[model samples]
Target: MTRQSRAHLTDRGAPTSRPVSGPADHPVPATARFRTFRVAAFALIVLVIGGAAIGLVVTRLLGPGATDVAAIQVHASMGGFDPPALTVKAGQPVKIEFASMDSSMHTDGGGWHQFAIDALGINWKVGPLASEVFEFTAPATAGSYSWYCDICCGGKANPQMQGTLTVTG
Candidate 1:
């Protein structure tokens, strides 16, 4: 065979001038580039909205400022709670501050008072001569809800230990 024919048929360990074609070699279409840009922009927008929503949720769960009313105070003594009845708006956020006005020497329940309302999932406690503050949403439906101090002040038997929560529409 001729020298030229042998070179064409077999490799001589030398570089070739011909270029290999692949994805990198070809230019991307304008439509494909735009589609990728659109997807990226959409993802960014979704991320921003999601982050904002999460931030709002965290802030609300963390502070009592989310409630419309400043805290309403209630004092617990051996006789009963001051302001035997409370009025609130239905479906509204409320903040309550319950305080124990008696010393630990009280005989009812050792001066440890509890504020509980089973229907609204409220159960709070306060030490003798101390106070506690908490927040909760009023029931959706307007109605009367009963509250009591089961500890330091008798459970539910004492008329003085009972209080009524009036939720209005």
Candidate 2:
């Protein structure tokens, strides 16, 4: 109620307080803040650009054109073909890579196994630890074709080394 007390009171009769500054309250220069933001933005841009470059390179390497050639890898062991079944689109070009994995002792001199599909006219002798690539177009008709090892594992009636190729439209 005194003049000195009234000087510390606000219009609503509450005490007035002054603002206090701490170490965290220090103002940063506009250029310094902008430089930090710019560096972060540049790093983000570089990351985006690098990701796009990698995607482009991968697309060029494994695009549809590269996949136009159907690459199939079949391993032959004592059991049979590894996959035992293969599927391809009708009239599509297919590249089959056959590997003979049979390690049994051979006295007939026929190597380990022989891949043959009498219907498709695909017959290739694959030796142990060796691989062969056969390129052919799938049959125009969509049907099931059988393949088997003729030499080492007998014929289609034998279930051990027989497989089926399915052609889809």
Candidate 3:
């Protein structure tokens, strides 16, 4: 309970004593200081590593995946789309050949354009005349599916560039 002073060597290599503030006014033991620092560092490392692992796992689980079927393509041209109606097997892949009939009259500088097909959880998107392919696993539960030009080229009128893929099981 008595106030004790801490002793240390000064820059001149001479012994010196300075007044200390805690328990008996003595400097804390080196072992206790090292133990506290070690514990804190270990905890920080564990937390950082744990967080990264969780993030990595979540990303893998939620990201997109490749469907079992093959790819299909369709063509879009000026005025309308070729093969306005398409038929595909129930559980296979169909490729659509996207060709531009008249580049001089099509929107987007009289050339091909790009758009996305965001339905049925399928990520099908490609550029004009670029031959993009999308795969439908199986008949999509036996129903009619419509694909349209997401691009705003139609203005106030219907783009007439849309098409339908009928899945037959």
The TM-score leader among the candidates is: 1
Cα lDDT tens digits for candidate 1, 38-113: 9999999999999999986674333223122468988777778777899999999988888776766767687777
**What lDDT tens digits, residue by residue, belong to model 2 across residues 46-91?**
9999999998667433322222234688777666787899999999
Candidate with the larger TM-score of 1 and 3: 1
lDDT of 3 at 122: 48
Q: What is the lDDT of residue 13 in candidate 3?
A: 36
Q: After the best TM-score superposition of candidate 1, give how far the Cα of residue 158 lies from its true spot, in angstroms.
A: 0.9
- Look at candidate 2 and give me any clashing residue pairs: none
- Say which prediction, candidate 1 or candidate 2, comes out ahead on lDDT: 1
Candidate 1 local distance difference test against the native: 0.74
TM-score of each: 0.57, 0.54, 0.43
Clashing pairs in 1: none
Cα deviation in Å at residue 58, candidate 3? 52
**What order do candidates take by TM-score, descending?**
1, 2, 3
Residue 83 error, candidate 2, Å? 0.3
lDDT-superior candidate, 2 or 3? 2
lDDT of model number 3 = 0.52
Candidate 2 stretches with Cα past 4 Å from truth are 1-70, 104-111
